[model samples]
Target: MRTGILSEVEDMIVDEVPIALVYNGISHAVMMATPADLEEFALGFSLSEGIIAHAGECYGIEVENGPGGVSVELEIASAAFMALKERRRSLAGRTGCGLCGVDSLDQVCRPLPALAPARGFHAAGVRQALGAIGARQELTRLTGAAHAAAWCGMDGVLRIVREDVGRHNALDKVIGAMARGKADPHDGFLLITSRVSFEMAQKASLAGVSALVGMSAPTLAAVELAERAGMTLLAFARGDNFVCYAHPQHLAVDT
Candidate 1:
């Protein structure tokens, strides 16, 4: 430790690049995201943003790397492409702000899928998943700046983890990975390494995941919306402890 002499050193940072999502050769959105998992990001963003109903609707994905930014090409079904063209939501996401480019309230709360009724998850399982997630966050370990989203089963097994500079991007990546892996949305709960936001809850609901747990507190709006979507919202989740903001019926305390 030098006395008042701070030394400049290079550190491994999370790479944030502009990823343009293109559908049928038409640019739909350009988001600032971590460079890895372009295909998963494409698929996840498409599904989460309601661009495509399901992963099968996306025929293929192409990642074009460039000096400027990466372009993700999604060859989606004609029906989905037409829907995207009609909706025409070309968002330029700066960070994880879910409603960055939304112009009006009507556009803000778009239609979401009907999430099934709440399924019980053991308290011990949630605690185990929460405790295990820190070790699974590779990028957070590397850069300490990225957020992570992990899909944990009802039994509390950490199934998959994805990271990005943006929390929304991380969650989207997890959802996309789940879609590609054919993981049943009904079989698990999603845990995010960030606060619970309305859009985050909305995304989970759209994917039909019944539970959302966050490392930080939930916003009032997030809890309200999540309640409407039939999700069990838990936040401020620490070792052997968490606060359930909504739908406590779904959280079965392990005796």
Candidate 2:
């Protein structure tokens, strides 16, 4: 028996597929993600995961669809490939799980470089980006289940936006797109529609992004990481209100 209030209706849902990041014929990790902007995801994951030091070290990337799922094969410089092998561990990724399949605790936190101080950032710019980003999120508008990551100029212009079933994947996609486009990381801020976590902060710092803004609160670990990295971290950002978690000095208050 069907309830009167419940009726069958067709609905659109976000797609989450298994994405394998294969390096030098070695399967390194697998993640659940939306099958869009995958090339950027691959590049971003590589850089953030420290698989390669720079984009130039990545010689090529190939995406293959198979019965299991999509596999992103990356060809990188021998040096980088060697480093990857040394730290090689299979990651059994789940949606939004940043740390999975790590064999030991030692690998949990990798050392990161201190970020250069961000400049020209204002609270008003954060508000402006927050207001404009919703309109640019096509996937979220369609599926309502996708998370978004956007690259925004200090002036509050949304330059690039990427969406995925997993927040981390979305961040990786936008970071990859930014690198592929040769955008200077220091010149802009990263806005994500997810809580700021340690891995999220780590990835942004690795990309040399000086500022990271989020639509939700940040974890304590994330706050500490951002503080040490000298990154300006903000969360719980809505129209005109936001909480600064780290390096508030970098963000100028708009009068």
Candidate 3:
């Protein structure tokens, strides 16, 4: 089971608070997320925001389990540290919501640069990856209060997984881990246990992964982003059927 403090159902209150990520003694953005996998959350946040190009850019990560929640102290490279500081300086703390803190509607729906078109991925392999994702979800299964993002290979091998209360956070964690571990994002597919959003699609593209599969629907913005990125976007993926939104040519559906 996922390691997290649990309260009985009906009495369970979702733990949400400001998690301040500090990089090389400089304060970065504060995210409101559940108090678990905080270290992963910090690294993931850093990667998704383009604060750190790779995991190795983070020299160290220290988690302080505090009263209200947790604080992540990250020792990042000088280059990434400067970028993080610039980002924080641009934010209006009072107006910014922790999860969706982009400048405007257009920024919120930023497009991903087009990538190499995907090779047709087998349906059976995709199904196997979906099942693997379900099995690896320790936190979500325990609290019924988390989202998961996984990186699975073309042959259904799950390379890495991350979980968070916020879907975006979960995806960030996965991407961060991949970058840190130097894993081959191009070797596999990306899967989410939540609906596909433009941000999610953007992150996947930035990670250079070619396909995304989700258990729910994709927003119109997300679909458009996937199309621009030349990535396959699969939604409503269930027992034997899935809706291919963009790049249907990349899916290996059977006769």
Candidate 4:
């Protein structure tokens, strides 16, 4: 056993910490998330979760460290604050339970706004996106554990990329960045380095994203939801091919 003392290696684990969402002085929700791009995370969560209509509605944000983990305080408009209070918002909202508290079919099949049809995406472009996303993943390069979500332009160019240990958080950060940058949600497709879970689909809908492509397979529930929302869903984007779950008409197919 003494010989083992001579051997040691540096290791890396993805960073995660408690992110408290405080609205207007009330402590609302606490989430376990990577401590980066948090201002974007807060704004994106607000818009996607229907807490605020847009980034403008959020007045200010402050982040600090508490006894446990990181805390994010959001100052939103009076109208948005009233709406949040009306919902009896608690820790309202995802790793496993993307659709939590759903014990009924109606809740599971809740209505989603129809997304506009997406522009066709060529196979070559899909392949390029698959290849290109990996290079943009800086955190994953360092931690080897972060997931990335990218927004690809209609021309197959990668515009925005965000990474986190949680796939959903990565998506949120991207959305927030896009919103701040005035990127058109319907003008391009979203690609994530994670499975197409139902929450991913839901958040895409919230962000007005008409298309979603993932590097992994999509779940049956995700397919069903995509079909109803009128969003194009594609997964297993690799090589020169991908699988389409809904609205295959959106893929150019010729490329």
Candidate 5:
């Protein structure tokens, strides 16, 4: 319906499905996502949400497709499972909601250690990565509803990319892929196709990523957290222009 005109048309759209992340037979969280990378999403969620300390803590991951939706079952270490049981909060996540179903205000923000200093990032590299990322987003090209998160090297090369209907899920997939590939988070920066939110910044910082570049604007809380965590936060990245919200010193001008 365009301007009150009724028309019949068929279009390609991104898939948004409920993905249940079950840990040790306990259903922890269910998020609406693209459902392409269930294993990566499960690993990344567990790591970013502090459910497990590291990748080694997660012994195994199994993906199950059912009639209703997809389920990702994870087998974690006993210590990590005990910790998860002690502080488990059920999350009912939607596509656009990051903090839905939080049981308490205290659980809203998780504590993270300050990130190590990141160096050798140039503005030219940021622009180069931004330019190349669009072509790599196959799902976005097919369905405009998809969002992507990319891990780029300091030289602006795209190392890994993950896409989903939800921005958080994409980032989680990237994190999980990075872990699986043994990529060093501090040696590169994260590029996202969505606005910089506090949760997004926190997730990157938790993964020891020192910089984040976004194609949209950044929230106030995101800037403040990035500053406190010693992260380089850049947003509104279009073409050769971008706004550095925090730690601008890390982005050097290329000669």
Candidate 6:
């Protein structure tokens, strides 16, 4: 179940495995991750990064465990394949980390496609969603070393949640799950247990999520990105109080 084990003591070190994402027969990135739910990992990584428009665009996903590590073979739409080919070619996936392989400004500040206007949402719904997300993190309860990304509808019911040691990976897993389930992104808001950064904002926008709620503070760049993407950004989501960064109109809070 783990890699390194203590002989005298009885503690297990969590296993880390290298998982590669291959898009249309061409390898794109190799990342060190917990070797579980990898099929979901591959889908989440692709959907959150804008490699495919939706799960329908993803033809198939295959998982192969080998001596080197795990390889996820993803068959995507022709247009996505071409776009990936034109973009960056190689990536080294670090452990549960974000923006590890990005070495250029172009990649960091890529323009996002316009998003739909945000619909009004009840404040209580957002609060209930956050509570539900906290309750749904089974792995986090076990390991206490993972982050969770979740989806909640306007009614405040959390429908989906994914956990990973890395913040980005968690979000990616959620995105992939949504794609595989063929869920509509416009139907809900995304809640995360990590800080809001530029890449996080990028992924949220790519998923067409109307609003992003984070338990931690957001970077200036993240706020700017969310504004451009027409998504609302909320930070410091503790209890019933939060700081709204963009699109405050969507928040139906009592004066």
Query: Which residue pairs of candidate 5 clash?
Result: none
lDDT of 5: 0.90
CA-RMSD of model 4 = 3.7
| Sliding window of 10 residues with minimal summed lDDT for model 3 | 96-105
C-alpha lDDT of all candidate models, in order = 0.87, 0.90, 0.79, 0.83, 0.90, 0.82
| Tens-digit lDDT track of model 3 for 159-192 | 8887778898888888877776777666788989
lDDT of 2 at 33: 95
Q: Supply the TM-score for candidate 2.
A: 0.92
RMSD of model 5 against the true structure:
3.2
On residues 1-255, what C-alpha lDDT tens digit does candidate 1 reach at each position? 369888987789889999998899998789999998879988998898888899999999999998999999889999988877766544333445446446456877777666775565778888989889989988898899999999998888899898999999999999999999999888889999899988898889888898899999888889998878878899999888899988888778965
Worst 10 residues of 4 by lDDT: 94-103
What are the models' TM-scores? Answer: 0.92, 0.92, 0.84, 0.88, 0.92, 0.85
The residue pairs found clashing in candidate 1 are none
**lDDT per residue (tens digit) for residues 87-202 in model 2:** 55343333444465344567777787878888798898898999999999988998899999999999889999999999999999998999999999999899999999899999
- Candidate 5 matches the true fold with a TM-score of 0.92
Better of 3 and 4 by lDDT: 4
**Candidate 5's residue-wise lDDT over 143-196, tens digit each?**
899999999999899999999999999999999999988989889999999999
For residue 76, what is the lDDT in candidate 5?
Answer: 99
Q: Candidate 4: what lDDT? A: 0.83
Runs in model 3 lying further than 4 Å from the true structure: 1-17, 92-94, 97-101, 104-114
Q: What is every candidate's alpha-carbon RMSD to the true fold?
A: 3.1, 3.2, 5.1, 3.7, 3.2, 5.0
Off by over 4 Å in 4: 1-6, 89-111
